[model samples]
Target: NSKINLAANELLFREGEAGQFAYLIERGRIAILRDSAGEYQLLSELGAGECLGEMALISHDPRMASAMALEDTTLTVITRDHLKERMARSDPLIRHLLQLTLKRYRQSLGQTFPDTSSTQDLDYLEDEQQAMQRMRTEHDLSHALDKQEFILHYQPIVRLADRITTGFEALLRWRRDDGQLVSPDLFIAVAEESQIIEKIGHWIIDEASQARTRLASAYNGKLSEDFYVSINLAARQFPDPELPGVVQEAIRRHGLLAQQLQMEVTESQILENREHAISVLHNLQSMGCRIALDDFGTGYSSLAYLNRLPVDALKIDKMFLDDMLSDQASRTIIAGMARLARDLQLSFIAEGAETEQQVEALSALGVEHVQGFFFGRPFALETKKEPA
Candidate 1:
C-alpha cells in the first residue's frame, strides 16, 4: 500500500467503523481510543515502526477502537487486497495455523469469525513486521546520508589480453558509526523503495568523481590513460529529468573529461521505461560520457532494440561464465555475445572471472575486458598505489 500523512490531532478512524485498511506507522505517533460512557478514552499510543488495525483486517470485522494521530504521522496503508495477495503465496500449514490463531483472537473479543478459509493473518502479520523493519532501515539510511556514513570502494576493470587495469567500477558501501560495513543488499532496496536512492545516487556520482581524481594521481600511469570510473545508475535514476545535469555537474566539478566517467544501467532497468531510458542515455552520451549495458543476456536483450539504444559497452553477466567450463550452451552464448559486441562496435567486458581458466576461456573468446575478484577485490580510496 502507498503512504499517507496526517497532521496532529487528526482522526485516523473511529470505533465501530468498517476496516477498509490497516496501517503501519512509518513515522510519528498515533493514539488508540475507545468510547466509554460517551467519552473517548485512550487505550494505547503507537509510534514509528508500529502497526495498527491489523486485527480488524484479519477478521473482516469492524474496528474495535478509534485511532487519532498523536502528532504529525506518516503511515503505510495495508489494504484487504494486499493481505489477500500475500495469503495466496503462504504455506498450507501456516494458513491453517493462522486460521486457528485468528479464530482464537476473535473469540477473545467475544466475536465469532465463521470463514476459516480467510485465515492468512500469519503472513500478513509477518509482512507487517518486515515492513516495520524496512521502514526503520529506510529511516536509518536517510540519516546515514546526513551523517556521511556512506562510502565508495573501487574495483578494478582489467583488460583481458594483457591483464592491465583499464578502469574501475565504483561500488557503494555503508559504514555505520560502529565502523562495521553494512552490506548494500540489506539497504539498497529499502533506499530504492523509499526514493532516497536518488539523493544517494547523486552523492555517489560526486564521491566517485572525486575518487577518480585521486586514483589518477595515485596510480602513477599504471592505469590506462583512457581509464574511466563506472557508476551504476539505479532504475529510479533513469526517469529523473535532472539525471543528465547531475552527471554533467559531477564531470565539470572534478575538472575531468566526460569520457572519464561511465554510467552503467541494467538491461531490465532500461526496459522498464525504454523510451525514457533511451532519451536519458542519449542525453548522457551526447555529453561524451560512456554508458554500459550491465548484466547483458540476463534479461530480454533483443538485438532489435540493442542497436537502437545508446550503449557503449556490454558487460556479460557472471552467470554465463560461472557455467562456461562445463556447459557448452554457456560457451556458445558467450561466443555469440562476443561477436555481438564486436558487431555493435561495443566494448565486451566479461564479469565474475575468478579463476585463471575462466580468464583464459574468456580471453580465448575475444572478450576484451573482465571484472571480478580474480582481477582485484574492491578496496578503499586510500589504498590506491596499485589495483586492488
Candidate 2:
C-alpha cells in the first residue's frame, strides 16, 4: 500500500535535492536524466519494478540525476528508516565496515567524521546525522552574520519626571530573505547551544557603541545628552575572559564614554556562574561600563546577588504591570521594588507599560523611567545623516 502516484511527464524530483528513500516503479516508466549544458541528457529509461535513486540512501548524498514520469506512474517507496532498522540488526562486523565506508565518504565530501566514540551503539549513526545538521546550521548563521541580515532596533526609555528620552535599549532582529522576521527567542537559543552567539554578541556590542555616535550627531538636538544604549548579553557569552577587553575596545573605537554603553544581564544569566560572571562584570564596571539587573522579580530573582553585584539599574518585569490595577498585591510588589531600587540608589524602569493609567501609577510610585509600547514601539534604526 506504500505507493506514490505521478501524472505524465511530472517531475519526481530534481537533481541536487536531498533524497530520503528509493523508489520501485510499480507501473508505467521513469526517465533518469542529468543536466548537460542546460539540456537534460537522458541517461536511462527505468521500467516497472526497477529501483531508482537507491544509491542516495546509502551515500546520504543529493540526487545525482533528475527523475521524471514518462507516463502515469506508481512507485513503491522504500524509506531510509526501514533500511536503518535492518542495518541496526546486522552483525557488529558489518556495522564496523559501514562506519569505515562512511568515514571515507565524508572525507570525499570535504567533511571530517563526527565525534563518535568507539563503544557507541548503532544509534551513533543517527547522532552523526544530527551533528552534520548542527554544523550546517552554524555554517548558515555564519553566512547570515557576514551578509548583515541581523539588525538593531531601538526602544526609547523615558524619564517619567520630564518625559524626555535619556537612553534607548538596542533589540536584535533577524529579517529572513523571504521577508518574514524571525523572533530572537527562537534563534538565539540555537546560536547559544552552538557557541555562535559569542560572535553575535561581539557584533551587537560594537554596533551599540557606533549607534551612540550617530544618535548624538543626527539627532544633534540632544547635545550634552549623556545618552546611553543598553544591550542584552546571553548567559553563555559571559564566560569569555576577553569580553571586558573587547567592550573597552568598542567604547574607545566609537569614541563613546564607557558609561554610555550599558550591559543588561538577567538574574539567570549572572546566576549561572556567579563567581566568574561577577569577576568579569567587576572589570567592566571599573572601566565605567554600567550594568543593569534586567527582568527583576522573574524566575530566580535573588536579592543576595542583586546587592552583591555592581548593577546601576533595575528593569521591572512586565508581568506586574499587566494586573497592577486589579490586584493590590501587584501594586504592592511594584511599590516595594521601586523603593528597593531607590534604597540601593539604582535607576528603575517598568517594562511593558502599554496603558496611560499604568504610566500615571508608575510616575506616582516614584519610578523614574518607563519603556514600553505606550512610549514607543521598537523603532527601526534609520541610517540617514543630517545635511552638512
Top candidate, metric lDDT: 1
Count of backbone collisions in candidate 1: 0
Report clashes for each candidate as comma-separated counts: 0, 0
Worst 10 residues of 1 by lDDT: 112-121
Candidate 1 has an lDDT of 0.84
CA lDDT of each prediction against the hidden true structure: 0.84, 0.81
Q: For model 2, how does the per-residue alpha-carbon lDDT over 1-388 read when each residue is reduced to its tens digit?
A: 3889999899998987777789999999999998887999999999987999885555555676799999999999988776877766654344555666755765685644333434434465665665566666667677778877788888888898888878889998887767667778867866887678898999889888888876666552233388799999999888876688789899988898899989999888888888888888888889998888888889665586678898899998899799987888888899999999999999998999998999999888788899999988876667453343
Please write out the lDDT profile of model 1 over residues 1-388, one tens digit for every residue: 6999999999999987777899999999999998987999999999999999987655666777899998899999988788676666754345555656867776797765354333634555565556567767878899998897998888889997776788999999999889889988888877877789999999999889878878887664257877999999999988667778888898888788999999999989988888898888999999999999999888976777888999999998888889999888888889999999999899989998999898988888888999989888888777333332
Candidate 2 runs further than 4 Å off: 1-137, 217-224, 383-388
